[model samples]
Target: MKTELEKMLAGELYDASDDTLFAMRLKARQLFTAYNQLGFEGTAARHTLLKQLLGQCPDTIDIQGPFYCDYGCHISAGENLFINFNCIILDCAMVTIGSNVAIATGVQILTAHHPVLAAERIKGPELASPVTIGDNVWIGAGAIICPGVTIGDNTTIGAGSVVTRSIPANVVAAGNPCRVIRQL
Candidate 1:
């Protein structure tokens, strides 16, 4: 089952080349432009963007104007979730954001990574790693959550931190390659 899911996700994402990804992103950007530019009020537009970004969303959610995602159908957001302006999610894989999560402006969540090996980087197949942020987590402004990471519940990621790995529950984490600092 794990391998099946992995294979399915790979087919949906990393099987394509950089050029392919760029084209796909370009199309998505056009759609986002049309969607956000739709002259709707706050509540109406928020739902419209959520519906565009995720397959299913809880009612108690609000993402302020101007959000971007590679493909909205691959992402799933939970209840009472709030993402501020300028949020971007590279949801090449399944991105499951939990309930009551608050993401500040300029935050980027990515679920895509390419090969690091010099010989195989170009020839090697792409990799898709899902990201799961637990409930009640507050992601600060300009934070980046990398692929295959799981941030535990009630954790606060400080502003401008780049989370490269999993973080434990109930703590404060911050840094370029983010690590647990201390209990919250």
Candidate 2:
């Protein structure tokens, strides 16, 4: 039988109240607290903490403290990435972010999504989907990237946009539903 974590990674509906999953989230919260409490000059220490949190962290990346993520092991970030303060990533499933990405403050990259129907939602199972962000992308402040969304390279998502669908390469997108404003 697949474990709850296994099921979650596979993008299947699974019980989130399982003990092991709960423990993992608790551990993440502990790490998050420690990372967020650091002083502004504690870059080296913050990097060390992020190495312990994320699945993979390249040598050349800068993430401003006060970041939050679920199951940090499911998040893999490439080099030259700068994630600003108050970033939250709900990485219930895989969250793959490529190099040279600038994620502004209060940006939320969420992979967890609940069922629409109350009947299904009240049940024990919850679903998750992976989020992919390509290189050379700039996600503005307070933007929310929904589950299963793939943002291509060299794109700029304007502030406060909610991305519900996949965005292609080399474009500027913004708005509640996040439409392409122009090709860059």
Candidate 3:
């Protein structure tokens, strides 16, 4: 079977990481800089570049400056998605964010995971799992979302939270390791 990383490189999966993924990543970053240097109204241009880099991107999307991604081909977002400044995504596997999502400043999403095996760890081969965020979710600033996490709709993740597990719908989650604090 084709690895997720391979699929990402092929533009099939929204997330995947492989040997050449870094090269593609650099290309996307270069394009980001190339377009970002154009100035403010360049939000449109930035979106254009992001659209090309990502596996998929909806029409209604806005991402501010200083956005970073390990592999844009592994990333995708739904409609009316608004991402603040300094967002980073390490999409080694598909990182899918649903419609009407609001991500605050300095949020990072990672879809890559490493094996616990010592020998495998030494090889430095990349492993990946998909991350699915449901619709109308609001992610706070400085949050780090880990691999294979599925966050349900209308959920709000607090600032500085580290999401290590899946979060169910219509709740408010926060803190390190990200637990559901209360219903939303």
TM-score of every candidate relative to the true structure: 0.84, 0.97, 0.87
lDDT order, best first, reads 2, 3, 1
The lDDT, on a scale of 0 to 1, for candidate 2 is 0.94
* Residue 157 of model 3, lDDT score: 97
How many clashing pairs per prediction, in order? 0, 0, 7
lDDT measured at residue 22 in model 3 versus the true structure, 0 to 100: 56
Q: What is the C-alpha lDDT of each candidate?
A: 0.81, 0.94, 0.82
The C-alpha stretches of model 1 lying farther than 4 A from their native spots are 1-13, 17-30, 39-42
lDDT of 2 by residue, 2-112 (tens): 999999999999899999999999989999899999997988888888898899998788888788998898999999999999999999999999999999999999999
Looking at model 1, report the run of 10 residues with the lowest lDDT sum.
4-13
lDDT for each residue of candidate 3 in 1-184, tens digit (9 for 90 to 100): 8854565434343333354655777787887677557677766777788788778887798888778886677777899999999898887678999999999999989876666788867665556678899999999999999988999999999999999999999999999989999997
List the candidate 2 regions with Cα displacement exceeding 4 Å: none
